[model samples]
Target: MAVPGAFVSSILLLLASAAVAEIQFSEIRSDDRPIIPLDDFGFTHRGWLELNVSGIALSKAGLELGNLGFFLCTRDSWLNVLKELEEEDITCALQSSHVKHVFTFEKLGQRTSFDVEFDQEDANQYTLIFANCLQQQLRVSMDVRSAMYNLDGKSGRRDYLSAGKTILPRVYYLFSLIYFVLAGLWVYVLYKKRLTVFKIHFFMLAVLIMKGLNLLCEAEDKSYIKRTGSAHGWDVLFYIFSFLKGITLFTLIVLIGTGWSFLKPYLQDKEKKVLMIVIPLQVVANIAQVVVDETGPYGQDWVTWKQVFLLVDVVCCCAVLFPIVWSIKNLREAARTDGKAAVNLMKLTLFRQYYIVVICYIYFTRVVVYALETITSYKYLWTSVVAAELATLAFYAFTGYKFRPEAHNPYFAIDDEEEEAAAEALKLEDEFEL
Candidate 1:
């Protein structure tokens, strides 16, 4: 009875082993047969299969099936998956089979899932429907988490290149180049003429050159972004350039204000002193702004400050116009009293200068308008800015040439006849006094 019982137990054990083996083989066959249904986020898919599994034998196929599925899935969603994976420095091995596409995802808690689907569209084209499903799942998860964590402080946050990376830097670079070149030419002319105005002109030129350099740096940064597919290193350079640009703009305002005061005889002493103080204060404020901007709530978006200062500049320019208008009026009155052709001619020249100032005022008004529009995120306004700036530069250059003493007299030497006549006039005046 004991022998019979032992033999029966051995037979049962053999039968159990065979059953297990058959089950394992069935699972392997199921994994090898690749027709996956994919559904996610308003999208559904059918017909995707795995290829190149000939090396994966039936015995060990179950253990390798999950990994193979993941590899295939990742291959299907390669573009989107690559972006996230590269950010985390994760890499996966992949081989594409013409039969089907694979989708894979690594989830929380070290869990991974993947699916394979066959291609119905084209034999060569295998779509990764599983990747789309995974992407939708991630999106939904993120949305739910975002809703839970939604707070006022975290609202409206954005990245650096949100304003469209390529265009702004390019526009700035081109405009800055043009501005610097024009300013440099103006400075050169002032220097050659031995004009006392050279000091202010040089300062303005330096400011424009610095602005140009900043734009060049920005362009280089954007180029780096295009090359590397990243904008990680732009912030430091951006902040440095921002601070410098503010300082330069402040200096420009001061230099122009002071030069205008020197050229205009009618400005009150108090006004002149106030302008001097304002210029330095603005410079200091701009320096402080750099620090404040870095730590402040507004952060790098403080480009709006450019518009603010430009508005102030427009106001100051308008104030300048008041004095110019008054001077022109006074000149006209004086011309009526003097009635001399030379005096009238001088008044006409001065009138021409006033007209030039008017043109500049219009140009600046347009600039302010465009600047405000830009601050408000109107990109097309820059075209107006460029046009107005070019016009202003052209008019300024023309006026500078027109008013130049050398333009009227190339040699700039007093004529012998005029010197003799002046000597005779002086002799006559002395005789009359005697």
Candidate 2:
């Protein structure tokens, strides 16, 4: 039994009429992500949405064809478009809110439909804009069932996300636990030694505590966000701790590189004033960064402020290097003139090398991680950051254990004149320490 020619002709005429009456769309390939949406863990965001639109149709439900215009929208900017469209006699639902970029198809294309793709940021909602160009009363039916991505595993990429989902939280949490243990042990050591003043022991303890808290924030950022599928407030703490870590790094290098006694007797006031300025500036900068993250695309002012404060922090960190390097050189030269101080000179030289290594390792790993995670989208490099921090901490712990403090000791090997000056200055100083 063959179908009649008249029936086939009638069906073709109906399709042609439908195309003229309303717009139609077909979805195409967008991102190569797996079925599960990847949680960005406070960095390195990536995803996309693509769609193909069939030709528009002109039908008389209640208004003229010339009054209608179709639009595309994404989650964040959809509300703006919707409010504007409503003022223009268009009513759109919030459900139709997923367009980051817009594409217009020529009304006279040879193909019946065209495709449009929107790169996903932190948004996921989509919408279509319908308008009455002539302000005439009209109603239209749109076929939008196939407009979004087909999440039935037919169009998305193969599973690269599942492994990340499972492994990332476990690894981050493991490191966090280790940091917590290290922080606890350091606290115990501080308590036992009765070193509660703003001395080197207390300062290092503070650094260790901040590092532990930072690791915990990272772990929570991964686990809770990945599990609940929403961001938490720990992100702010993460940024704050990160900047503090850099500040402490600067302080640690200066303190260890130039021995506390020399700084205490000669330059305590200058160092304290500079540090007071630097620490507050870093805190404010880090706070701005957090505000920018919270405010998203609308935080340009805060972003600029953050960049400015970051420059301030950088300058402060760099300035500390002068005092550190100068002190190291002076001490090394003084040791050379007196052969009796050779053993201490060797130890001092070794300490200098170790401190330099720690600083270099930290900055190098930070740059690598930032490039890989934020710029290149290689999220696995987060593990490298964790490993580097752990190794740095281990080095610090070993050094501190080996170099216990002794009273009236001359581990720094300064010249006799400098020693006499330091002795005289210490004798004249008040009991209050810097």
lDDT string, candidate 1, 145-207, tens digits: 000000112443211221222244566678667767866776677667664453445555566
Residue range 77-106, candidate 2, lDDT tens digits = 544544545465334322234322234322
Candidate 2 ranges beyond 4 A from true positions:
1-167, 187-198, 236-246, 261-269, 301-313, 336-340, 374-381, 387-395, 398-434
List TM-scores for all candidates, in order.
Answer: 0.40, 0.51
Task: For model 1, state the Cα shift of residue 415 in Å.
Answer: 14
Candidate-wise lDDT, in order: 0.38, 0.45
True-structure RMSD, every candidate: 23.9, 16.6
